[model samples]
Target: MGKIEIVEGDITREKVDVIVNAANSSLLGGGGVDGAIHRAAGPELLAECRDLRSSTLPDGLPPGDAIATGAYEIKKVKWIVHTVGPNRHAGQTDPQDLARCFSNSLHLARSLSARSIAIPAIGAGVYGWDHETVADLAIRAALAEQRERGGIDRIRFVLFSKDAAAIWSQAKLTHLGR
Candidate 1:
């Protein structure tokens, strides 16, 4: 089994079995992680995503729900999981949805037999979430899920900024015991 890692780095730079993209429900290439992943993965990634956007999502790409795609230049990983994140809100629903995102991604990674996976701080950027709070929820959810399935040995929270990284670092220390 691998281990949980809270690292300060770029998602594009991480070499893992799969990287989860904090994407919109549409699953189309847009700003934030979606744009970054598309930019790094090239136009072919958009080409593949086009079909998902055009076709009707019978079950709907609800928040916290994830879908898979083939990996591009980003090395080591064979697949990328696109999970929808909750937008900023003053209600408990947002946190609940955010937690579901982790759950869904973990499930997908396990189903794919992926031992190493990386994820961004979901809902902490454009979504307008407080970094520390979201970090606690995300880390706790990931750790709890790990304890249950024992599938994802390496689960990483790849932060884009030093501030975000520091928040995760503190949260990991205070909650997950580092």
Candidate 2:
């Protein structure tokens, strides 16, 4: 089984095989983690998102679904898996939708033959999801995917704040009874 870990740092800096972006449906980049990732991954990432928008994902990506794009200049990562998390403020508060963000990202990573993935706490920031709630959903969903696929060896919950990281860390410990 893959191990899930939490870290307090910039997700863009992680040396994982893939980094999951908390992207908006447009996949064109927005504030929070999305914008930070776009900025770090550079313009090539934006161009790929534009291509996705222009072609395969013409109407933009939907919430809960995930897509992969080249990481471009972002060091140490091969791909960026973008998943649009449900926006609770917009009445898209279904836990299943939130869970899909994790599961689908993992699915994409497994498809990409990724050994490790770094993910942000999707929807827990400006999207209005409580940190603890997101942590629990992410943990459960990721574990389920790992069990089913058994391809990824590491899943990292990367947070920008120490408080958020601590919340995820504790949630994992509690969920796994460690």
Candidate 3:
């Protein structure tokens, strides 16, 4: 295992073994992080997603579930892990479901033997969960998973905005004390 790290910046610019896409259950591109990931990864990414939807994932999977695809334009990673986060409804996020997204992503990365992975604050965007809370959940899940599996070298929380970036930066200090 490698030293745990917390970085503040745009996910698209981060160099890691893989980056996660907070996709909709349909596995097709939706708004917020989902849309941005698809757009950044390029049209081929959308095409591959559509091809997967047409065959591999016809009816769509449940939230907190994830799938893998080839990294399109993102230079650093060889693969992209796409996971559907629980939509914010009725008030707070479902803790178990939200955590599943993080855990499941780590599981996929571990299975792929990835040395490092980058993730965004799941459910923090249009889902409207508090950034600090979501980042804590993400950090906790990744650290826990890595502790058990023993392969993941690093986890990066890539933030799209400065406010969200600050939330993760503070999260690192509060939770990891680093």
Q: What is the C-alpha lDDT of each candidate?
A: 0.80, 0.91, 0.81
At residue 111, give the lDDT of candidate 3.
86
Which RMSD values do the candidates have, in order? 2.2, 1.1, 2.0
What TM-score does candidate 2 get on C-alpha atoms?
A: 0.96
Give the Å error, residue 140, model 1: 1.3
lDDT of 1 at 175: 74
Tell me the tens digit of each residue's lDDT in model 3 across 2-96.
Answer: 65566666677778888998888787787877787777888889899889989989988677888899888877777889987777774546788
Off-target runs (Cα >4 Å) in candidate 1 are 56-60, 89-93
For candidate 3, the lDDT comes to 0.81
Write the residue-wise lDDT of candidate 2 on 1-178 in tens digits.
8788899998999999999999999898989899999999999999999998999998989999999999998979999999999988999989889988998999899999999999999999788899999999999877787787456899999998989998999999998999
Off by over 4 Å in 3: 90-92
Query: Residue by residue across 1-178, what tens digits does model 1's lDDT show?
Result: 3466788887877898899888877776778777888788877777777777777564447887888888777767788999877877644355888888888888888899888899998888777788887898888877776787566888899988888888888887887554
The residue pairs found clashing in candidate 3 are none
Arrange candidates by lDDT, highest first: which order? 2, 3, 1
TM-score of each: 0.89, 0.96, 0.88
Better of 2 and 3 by lDDT: 2
Q: Model 1 Cα RMSD, Å?
A: 2.2
TM-score of predicted structure 3? 0.88
